[model samples]
Target: MSRTEQELRQLYASTRGMPTGAAKFAVLEEVIRHADALGLVEFAFDVRMSATSVFQHSWAPEKAFLTFSWCLAAYDREPHRFGSGHEHTLLWQFKWMAYSVYQYPEIPLQRGTDLLEDMERRYRRGGHSMHAVLQNRGEAAQFTGEVERAQAYYEEMALTRRDALSDCAGCVPSSQVQTLVALGRDEEAIRIGESAVRSGCTEQPQLIYSELLLPFVRSGLGERAVEAHRAAYRRIRDNPHHLGELALNLLFCVHSGNLVRGLDLIERHLSWLDRPRTPLTEMEFAAAAVAVLSRSQEQNGGDGGAVLRFPTVEGKRRPDTPAAELAVELRERALGIAERFDARNGNTYQSTRIRDWMDTGAIGEPLPLSVFERAANSRGGERLQRLLDQVADRTAAGDLVAAARTRAAAAELMLADEQYAEAAEAAEEAIRELDRLGLTADAAACRWVLARAYRMDGPGGSGVRALRELLDSDPWGREPQDGGPGVSPEAPQRLQPLPLLPARPELEAALGQWLGYGPEAAGWSLAAARGFAAAGREEEALAALGEALARHPDADAEPTDGVLADLLGETGAVLGRLFGEAGAPGRVGERGPTGPTGLTGLAGPADRAVSPTVVVLIAYAEHLQAIGRLEEAAERLRTACALLDAHPDTEAAGRRSTVLTDLGEVLLRLGDVAAAEEFARAALALLEPDDAWEEIVLLGKVLRARGADEELAKLLTEHGLELEDLDD
Candidate 1:
């Protein structure tokens, strides 16, 4: 092989381990340039082909056109030199090129239409099915406001059999679903989407979930819509490539009375609008953000402003801007982009769609997205009546298991309503019926309700004992094993862990609060986290902690004299024993005399514990990092660090470094190399000449970012670590 070829191979190999994003794309572009300069025709074609995919996944898919055009021209001049494989790849890329053509007004409508016809002719000549060609035609027609034509093409595409050239199973249906929804055929869209989700696809559920959000809401299936939003948002929240898809979810939040949540989504992803992958996607996202921000502005009497954090140099923060101002700005940008598309298409279609979406009003009523929120926000009498109706219907049908399950559900609602006595009674009846029917899972759920009721109703420690007994008995007949928490073999997969999910987390948090500072409290909190993790409900878990924080003493206030002093003393004694680095080293609550509110002992010089708020905030940061919400996670970690900075406590002081290290890692993920380096250095400065692996690893990221290989090697040698040790 030639030296140039070997060099190209080495460059490609080095990039294999790099992540997919701007950096990788830039490197791939460089490789293409090198191949072109070295007079490697086929090699340059190969590199450009890879560059096209990288472009498609990056924030500028339209940028692929230049490289793709070169490849197309090369193939047309000498098809035999590249082989059938290259021809097929070239034809497939033609589909993307055709779609991209409509994204800009600079490319005329005739250009897109001609490209579609050319794609069809080539597919026929290559002996390929018209499936992919028809699909692209339909999408192009849809973009150009030819809904009827789009529908006809979609119908024809559906009838056509799949071939190696057709889009993936999930993708075609997702596109069709979008077209159907636009054509006022929501039910049909939902039908297609439901089936597609059931059968699965390469991007199953995730891609289709966003497409189905509007359909489900339009069909008055609000609960299902909420579930789709949660699932879709979780899947796409971390992916910068899914900005357009995430926009749909933001609109759902607006229509469903989740104004705060809509704002949260906006805050998390608004930076994506800075450089949207395509103008079409940018218009969609801006339209959605306008809708959300406008509604939020009205709700706040046009006074509340949202503080959005954009990616900035040196961890600099963006200024707080009013919702109305941001809304107007986004609205103009969206309308302008829409006008460009419409002008290009010689119609008002794109602009009208953008205006309609921006001005869209909420549906009849707000939909609560979580089980607990639904139960809590629902009207007490109406919700109870519905649960009772279910029980009556199940009983009349002679479905005893169903009736018992309904009763358990009703009991949960009753607890939320504070009807503790009636809830406890209902729970007992359900538990007996389920146990008799040999439904261990159902029975276990009822027992949890009963335990909760026992706690809320009266007898102190009754709820605690009952929960302990239930856990000890191993109601699932197994420990949490393989994959996640195990359930009884007979238990339904959907109902694993418990009946009311979010309710279980709430119960765990309550149990932790009731126990106060001890091993039991920490255990309960951990259990709550595990349950939430198993359910893929990170937001709800953090929310549960937030609720717990509210219930605890005024953590924001300093511990002075009087009641505050005594409270702190009591809290400090128990927390020091339970959580401090150097304590009695026995069971929590083993030291000190019993005092006010069941707290143990008085605070002394030896009892300086970290603030509970700081601890929980740090934990929230960690969980947020795990779920890919880097910016928000960094915010929470900074909050924790600030709290530590204010107090300067001796207990768990290493946590300050841990928080800084975490913030630095999150900055690294966000591509703020300078900010990441600063935080890493701060964390390292806080350390007292210790070789803490996490801090060292964070510093290593800083060195590597600067291409300081010599410095990194020396640091590693000094710390007795290796490059591999710092990976991941």
Candidate 2:
């Protein structure tokens, strides 16, 4: 090795040896030179390693800014060498690029565009090139809804450059081939793209060309897509450190009939997704890799004796609801994904090899939400096609951007349809394509959509990680609207909560629980609870609601009162969300309660922690109930109950009693004698209502229990609880 390379080895050695990271990293910094040194052939590798290590350790935004500056330094010298080291320096550099574009929000638009352009020029043909510059550009084109422009840019870029590149086949001719393909010169494009890969030109351009050619090779070339997947797999499988590359190869495996192995590959990514506060880009890679692989297996080759198949019930009959019908309600928005790559429309570009891309399980249409009960007659797979023609056709056309867009569109539609798990996957593909195409803002949109979908779906393990990424996505000021930088978490909101993207309380709570943080967790939990109440996540909104209610300082039996008696109860739910919901019911009396217009909603008189979400529902419910709309009041209570049930952490007793009380009231109004009695009795058992008035309410319990007058007479006389005899 050269002198500079020698130092790099020492840098790696020094860091590897030190138990203490900072000291070791300090040595690394001293030993390795930046990109300027021609002798430092491993410059990109060392710098990337150092960048990821440093970011993991410090995570200070400034540290990242410095690292990105170092990354940019590479371009200053060997501009074409931007994606050096087979694009192995990806996570480190991609994260930096995203951060650089997203942070420093105050930078002018012209400057921002100039910076991106410069980066593209410097790093135009590698994995980093495709995933970064091209992806970002595609996003920009997409966000303005410039479908044709986006398609052209993405197809050209996706076809010409790729990750896992070789160094020998220089990309000029490949670029020419791609241009030819863009002009509809299929034979020329296919020949050049396939030849480059076939000749073992693993250069960045060739790999990109190979990816562009995958569908056609499988379709007519026969087994080329399979061979390419195997080649890609061989290059990546040994090193678990090649997490991103491994994931990509795994995606190909699913379509190539090596799906059993793809599961193992997807599983490895779970580790990354399980971490708290993972960066958005990393999250996208992991989520996409796993989701696509899973789809590939489930969607394809299962008729009769095909290798892959969806799990089916043995003896048990299907549920009244059919799976496909459920899937549509689940993947409604995903319909767009199917269309995104279709070669049928007036707007269609390529999309002929859709079958090649899809090895296939579900390319079925989504059922409308309103027909839930009657939908069991939905598409039964017994007589199913082994492959979905949708994705395969698109892939054959060499329109990767469109393929990815289809997935994203599918994810969005699925989310709208309430099919959370599948939606997250499609969104991931969309993001991957967007990132590759340089569609920064559009990528952000997809990430938020993914996060929001997972927020409701993916289990705590991967879902929370997804949300954290969305929250951490760089603002880039490149949002479709004027939403400025750092407004990432707002991705879930259609309007893009720009100008600022502070975590919603509900999201904060989920992260807090997932991350194992304390106050921050409570804060997020509180926020989420309130948001759900606003959005009617009813059962899911209760726990936060009850604590908020109990913690409010004014939760008493009020000034012989007006209409606000119901509102006092909301304090418990709100506080439950903010502080730990531990030991809450007893603490609820501390919340002030008064009569009439004066009783402000849920919050302690002294603490501003109580937000409006708590007080408003109660007031609204009670108001409506008082106006003789008992049904509305019951729904409000049910809403609170649902919120509590969904909270991961909640005081069990408090959550239970609060929900039971609402159920009791509703059942009583509906005239369900036994049901009302059971509900009330359950609440009374849990709610230790000790006061004279509460005792009177409990007396009604006795009447419901035994022969009305028999037990009541004995209890009333012994307790001296005559309503006629006692004066207030």
Candidate 3:
């Protein structure tokens, strides 16, 4: 063997019993890099083997794609170098291709089928061990929506398996179970799975359990479904990397009313879904998370909306009741994941399906504004109009709660469209209905809308008055009177506090009373700070932000804290403006009331256990930029870029693109025109055609400065972003 081959073999042997994670992948990557450098003919085969190991452990689509692409390329260049193991390698290659086709529909099915056919032709040449190849072909057929062909292939494998000597005997039963399930032979599938489990032939136990879960659940065998779920969970518990199996188990948990367990699994593993390595897996994870949360909402007697407003399950809690707060947190987290995925990937068919599920579930919620918001954001006017019509229908049908929510949403949409009169009318109707329904929380939201409408149109004070009433009433803490007009046994006794109403001094004072005390005080204070800032009361905004920072000291530790990050960013801007107004010295370590020019005092805890997030870094940079501290700002932007590189998720990618553009602008100010242009071009390349117009405009400026007018004009014309629109 060549020295490179020896090294590769030694590396693989060293990782034999090691756990799957970054460490294992790190070693594998090193071996692949070494193999590539040596120009070995076995490079493709080596990568394919490593890719199989990764798929078995992590199931990361991007990782698999990288290795598989290399393998295919190498095979094309030197097919003869595959040696005696060529047939086996071909089998595995085709199998992986089929798996990829199943996972990512974006990969055309014909490509996978063509690979499978090639493998079958090779198998026919030697007539040796075709069971595994045939079974995989069945899977590819099924994934491509060719059900009959898949079944035929699967049956052929089943018949051949008894006489064939193959290591994939266990896989045959598992495949058979899946085919049976797809054919609506649930009983047969369950029987086969159960028999395999009992006979000790379940080599791929996770697959068997996954196949059995749906059939058992659909058959109303909750106990059996639970058993399958537990088994599947245990099989993958150590790795916790099989997205498909995890999602299947989650579905069973939700469907069988094991919501607490489902939630636990989600909380434990949801963070792993952050990488967006595989669009299909990410989609599945989001769908499963949303489904679980929706079921939990229903079980708790709340509407199954993406936006969760309720605090308790069934308006009552025994000492044994699970924490409803955790459930709400999970629901919010799930919604965030779905939203981030949608933002990065845009609207794929899978994403749209998940969105539809959320929309349908939102109809059952106290407020369906989330659905309306999504429709408006996506420019799905037909969906918004349909929802409006539904609101009207609900009103005519006297479903007051549904009508009120839909009307409020309609009002928001009308406001967005700048139809102030229509917004006012809709908001008023919603408020009236909500008030009559005794939905204090819902009413408060509608009142806020009405207030905005009033402010925009005729009487600004009406909006302020509405906000004042909401605050003074302390609706969230109010007790329901026995037999009151708007009270029902099922109605929540205390209203959940509404998000901070549009910033008025009156609203600020009310929020202030809860500062450092209420459960939501930090959020309230942040809102108050935003209000004060908007009203040009910088000092008050700074004070409110101080209070917020004191309450949520660990903000930087939680990268998912988008709200807190925004608050911090806004506060940084405020502080920067204050520093600028006072004409402070341009020293790097200049101190303000908040400790440093960069708001370093806001960094939580003494050990600084976690580094500041990209959000915090960018926000601090923004503050520096606002105060004319260009060098410090550029350094902070570099830090943000590093953070983005470390965590290459969809959300991080979006942030990276923004930071690049910002960095380019900073570089331009520093007279590094060439470097700035390069950064701008890189940012442009990272962005999708439909990405934020702001980023595009920033990059356009760089291109314009460099006299790349052709590229600039092409970008503008392609994205339909006219120069006049940019000016607006």
Measured by TM-score, the strongest candidate is 1
lDDT of 3 by residue, 1-728 (tens): 34567767766666654445667778777777777677754753666666565754464645765676666666667767765465456455555555565555455555666766776675667676677677787776654445677889877876774323243545667777767776778988887777666445534677788878778767877656655665565455434456667776776666555554566556446655555445555666666766777667776687542232221222332232233444455445445555554453344433454554333321111212222222344342664576666765676797777666666666777676666655765666566556556676666656666656655654223344444455555554555432222233332111221122343544554444423342245566677766555564544554566566545534223334565566555655543433333223232133334433233332221112112234445555554565567787787677556545544653445677778888887887787878887887778777775776666776666667678879989978877877665442
By TM-score rank, best first, the candidates go: 1, 3, 2
Estimated TM-score per prediction? 0.53, 0.28, 0.41
Model 2, 1-728: lDDT tens per residue? Answer: 33455556644654553432346546555554433355564465456456555544332333444555665565546646655453455433553444334322233345546765755654553324444455455444432234456557656665655554222344434434434534455665666555555454434432443344434433454344444543444343322233434434544554444443444344333343332122322322443343454364345442212122121112222233322332233232223332342322323321222223222322222212111112234242211111112234456787665444444544555566676654554565566555656555556657667667656652233455456655555344343432432233323212212112333544555565554432334344445555655654533454554333333223122322221333333433444432224423233324443223222333232222222333434444444444455665565555544444444254356555645655565556665557656666666676554523343444455364445776667757766667453222
User: Tens-digit lDDT track for model 1 on 284-393?
Assistant: 99999999988887777777555443323123345656778888889999999998888788889999999988987688599865333344444558767677666667
Candidate 1 has its poorest 10 consecutive residues by lDDT at 599-608
Which residue pairs in candidate 3 have backbone atoms (N, alpha carbon, C) closer than 3 angstroms, thus clashing? 451-463
| Angstrom error at residue 124, model 2 | 16
Which residue pairs of candidate 1 clash?
A: 59-277
Better of 1 and 3 by TM-score: 1
lDDT of 3 at 441: 61
Q: lDDT (CA) for every model shown? A: 0.69, 0.44, 0.57
RMSD of each: 19.7, 24.8, 23.3
- Model 3, runs deviating above 4 Å: 1-14, 40-48, 65-82, 161-167, 198-203, 303-728
Off by over 4 Å in 2: 1-65, 68-112, 117-189, 198-206, 209-213, 239-248, 272-728
Better of 1 and 3 by lDDT: 1
Candidate no. 3 TM-score: 0.41
* Winner on lDDT (1 vs 2): 1
* Stretches > 4 Å off in candidate 1: 1-4, 304-316, 370-728
